[model samples]
Target: MARWEIKNVRIAGVAAAVPRNVVYTTDFDFFTLEEAEVFNNTVGIKQRHIAPEDVCASDLCFAAAEQLLADLKWERESVDVLIFESVTGDYKTPPTSCLLQDRLGFSEDCFSMDIPMGCCGCMYAITTGGNLLSSGNAKRALLLVGDTALRMGSMKDKSRVPLFGDCGTAMALEYNPTASDIVVDFHTYGKGYEALMTPHGGFRRPITKESFEYEDFGNGIVRAPLHTLINGMNVFSFAISKPPRSIETFMADYRIDRERDVDYFLIHQANKMIVDRIVKKLKLPLEKVPYNLEEFGNLGGASIPSLMVTRLRKQLMTEEKSLLMSSFGLGLTWGTMWLRTQPMVVSELVIL
Candidate 1:
C-alpha cells in the first residue's frame, strides 16, 4: 500500500455521461424470467446503461468533460493537464488521453496521458492530478475515469452481462493554496488479476483463431476468449475485506473520525452486499454513504463521479463537503481517498 497527501488543490466540479440506451434486467436475453428475478433481487441492479458497439469509452468521457468544462465556465486553454483513465482505449497505439485533449479543444501545451486501469482508476487519477496542481506548475487539470466495461461482456455471459453498466465521468481540479488537502491510499494485488480479466486480445495473448470462439460454461456463463471472465468469490471477498481495511487504516493514519470529519463515503457501485459489508465494518452511518448502483448499476471507475452528479449534486454545488471515496476491482486493485469539497459547479447528469 502507498499513501500520500496532496496540498493546495480542490475539486472544482464533477460530471458524468452515460449512454442514452438502457437495458433492464428483465430484458436480459440470456436469463430465464426466474433467473433474472433472482439475480436482480440478489445483486440489486435493476438496469444498466450500455454503450452501443460503435461507442468507445473515450466518447462518453468526452461528453462528460464537455459538460464539466461548460458548467465550470473554465476556458479550454486554461486546463494545463488532462489525464484519461480507462481499460477501453480508442486504439492500441495512441493513448486515449491524447485523443481527448484534442477533442476537448485543450491547448497544445496541456500535458495529456492515459492510465489504463479499472474501478480504482478514479482515486489514482485524482492523486495524480492533485499533485500536479499542487506543484504550482499546472493551475487546472481534468481527471477523467470511466469504462464501457460491459462492452467486453459476452451477451451470453451470465456471470457478467447483467451486472455491468457503462458510463464515463470527469472531474475538474484547480490549484487553490488555501483549499483543503487530499489524502489517498492505494493497494494492488496483481497476483489476483486473473480473478477478473479478458484472457486474450492484448499483446500478451494476442488475437488467436480461438480468441473469438465462445464457450458455454453452463448456468448461462458463456464467453469468447476476447470477453471478460470473473471469479465472483474472489472479487466479493476482496470487496468486503480489502477496501474496508484500507479505509479504516487510512482514517486511523490520518486521525479522521468519520462522524466528525467526513461528509460522505462514495464507494464504487460494484455490488450491494459488498457495499453494505464495507459500510458495516467501518461502523459508518448509512446516511453517510450514497449509492448510485440501484439506478446506474456498477459503473467501474465512473462510480464515484457519477455518484456525485446523481446522488449528491445539489449538496456538492451548494456547500463545502468532506468526502471519502473508495473504489476497488479489476487489476485486483483497491484504494481510498479523502478530499474536502468547496461549493462548486456540479452538473446535471449528461446523457450521451
Candidate 2:
C-alpha cells in the first residue's frame, strides 16, 4: 500500500540494447522438440538474446545510454543524476552506477547510485529518478535497467533457462515544470522471497565449493546453488495473483479509467501465460497490453522499457499518451506507475 505521486518530471526518451546471440528454446539440448514446443505454448517464449560470456549488464546498458543520449543530443555534463537498476551488476563491491558514471562521462557533480532488483527494478528506478527531479535536486536523470539473467541459470534447467533473456535499457527523465504528476504504487511479500532467488553467493550464504556442485532438482531440472532457483508453481501463483491486484489498486487509487484514461499497459515480460492471466484478471482489452515475449523472452527489469522501444516506439514518438506500467519478480516485489508521455525520441534497438 505504498503509494505516492511525484510531479515536474517527464520522460524525454528511451532506448534498449540486446546481445546479438540468438537462442531458440527448441535448440536447447536439454528439452526434446516436443517438450520445447509444449513449453513455448505454455510459457510463451520462443527465443531469447543471450549475452556472450564476456558481456555484462553494464555493457549492454552503456550501449543503450549512449544511443539515447545521442538521440536526445543532451550534453553528458547536463545529466544531473544517474540510477542503475539490476540484480546483475559488473562487480559485487563498487556500485555499478559509479562505473557507468565514469564511462558515460557525466559531470562530477552528478548523483549516482545502484539499485539491485529484478523484474521490478525499472519501475523502482523511474520512481526514484522522478522524485529527484520533482524535488528540484536534479535537472535531468538517466534511469538504466538491465540484466544478464540468462547467465545466472543452468543451461539444463528447463524451469528457468528458456524463460530469461539478456537486455539493457535507458530511460531519460528531465525536470519539466509543466509535466503532470506521476503516480506510483509499490507492494512487497517478503515471505515469498525464496520463490525466486539464487540460494548462494550472498552474505548470509557465501559462495563455497559446494555452491557450484550441480544436483538434480527433479523434472529434468538440475542446478547448483549458484544458479538461479525458481519454484515454478509458487512463482506462477504469485504472478497470476499479485500483478492484477496491484494494477487494480493503482488504477483505483489514482482514479484512472482503463478504457478512457490509459493508453497502454506495459507489463513485465515474465511470460505469455502470466501476462495473459493478468490481462484477463483485470478484464483489460487485449489491444491495450503490448508484448514482445515472442522475440525477446523475459529481460527482467529491462522488459518494460525495452518493450516500449521495440513494440510501441511509433506511438511513443508520434502521439501523447497515458501509460501504466507494472513489474513483478525477485524479492517478491511488485509495483505500478502511471505517467503521461509526450511525443519523444525513441531509438531503435541496439544489438551489441
Candidate 3:
C-alpha cells in the first residue's frame, strides 16, 4: 500500500506580480462614479494595476516566478517541471511556459508546458502540479498563471476594460509524504465556454478588423465586441452553483466536516457579487473568505496566489489552519483543493 493516502503535499511558497502602473477609480472620465450612475451603482472599485502596454502575459508570469523561486531558495536547475496555466498568452504558437523557462534561465531539462484555462486555471494548476510531484516523477514544480487580458479591448468597451488588471502568480510545490494532507479536484463545463470567453484570436475565430463589432447581451448591456462575448448572467449563475458543489464533493470524498475543518476559503477573485453569492450559497462564514478584490480587483488566474501572498504577509495563515481553496471563472472551469498548512523554510530575500 502507498505509505500516504495521496494527501500530504504542503504548499512550499507563493508569490504574485502586479503591474507597476496603478489606476484609481477616478482615472476614468465618463466611467468615473461621479459621472455615471451605473458606475456609482456598481460601486467604486478603488484601484487596479495596469501592465505597461509593451508587456505581455508571459512577462508578468516571469516576474512573479522570479520572486517565488527566490523566496523558496529554489535554484533554476532544481525545478523538475514548470506548469503554466493562463487564459492569456504571448501568442498562440509557442507555449508560454517554454518561453518563461528560457526567460527565467532554467535548464533545458525542465518539463515546460501550458494549460490554457480561464479563471479556474490557478486551482487546476495547483491540483495538477501537486499530483505530478506526489508521483515522485518530479520532486519540485513551479506553477505560474497570469493574464494581460486587459489589453483585449479598445477604449470603447467600458465594462470589462477597466475592471480587469494584469497580474501573475507562482506557487512552489514539493513532494513530502511525511506531511500527508493535500486534496484536490478540478472540473470543467465546456458548454459554458460561450458564456464567458474571448471568442476570437483562436483557430475558430481568426482575428479580423470586423471582429471588433460589439454585441449586447440584452438589457442595454454592451460587452466586448463579437470577438469576445461574455454573458455575465450565465457566468454568474454557473460560478455560484458550481463552487459549492465542488466543495461538497471534496468534503464528502475525504469524510471531512466543512464547518469545523476549513479555516479559510481562498476563492478566486472574479468580482464581489460573484463571491458574495457563492459564500452565501455555501453557507460559509463571511470571515472565512479573504478579500483582495476591494484593493486589487480581479487578476483572474493570479487571484488566489496574490490573495495568499497578502494573507501570508499579514501572518494571517499559519500551520494550524486547514484551508479549502476554490477557483472559478471563464472557460466555465472550476476546481477545489484542501490542504493543511505546514511550516516551510525560506530565505528572507524571497518577496522583494
Model 3 earns a TM-score of 0.88
Per-residue CA lDDT of candidate 2, range 1-352, in tens?
4887889999999999999999998889988999989988988899999999999999999999999999999999999999999999999989999999999999999899999889999989988899888977779999999999988888878788899899999999999998988889899999999999989999999999999899997888989999988998999999999888878977886789999999999999999999999998999988999989989999999999998999999999999999999999999999998999889889999998
Q: In model 3, where do residues sit more than 4 Å from their true spots? A: 1-8, 32-44, 213-227, 314-318, 345-352
Give per-model TM-scores. Answer: 0.97, 0.98, 0.88
lDDT of 1 by residue, 100-139 (tens): 8889999999999899778888888898888889988889
- Name the candidate that leads on TM-score: 2
Provide the clash count, candidate 2. Answer: 0
- Candidate 2's C-alpha runs over 4 A off are none
Sort by TM-score, best first: what order? 2, 1, 3
Please report how far candidate 2 places residue 257 from its true position, in Å. 1.1
Q: Top model by lDDT, which number?
A: 2
**Local error of candidate 3 at residue 195 (angstroms):** 0.8
Scored by lDDT, model 1 comes in at 0.89
Q: lDDT rank, highest first?
A: 2, 1, 3
Note the Cα lDDT for every prediction shown: 0.89, 0.92, 0.73
Q: Residue 320 in candidate 2 has what lDDT?
A: 95
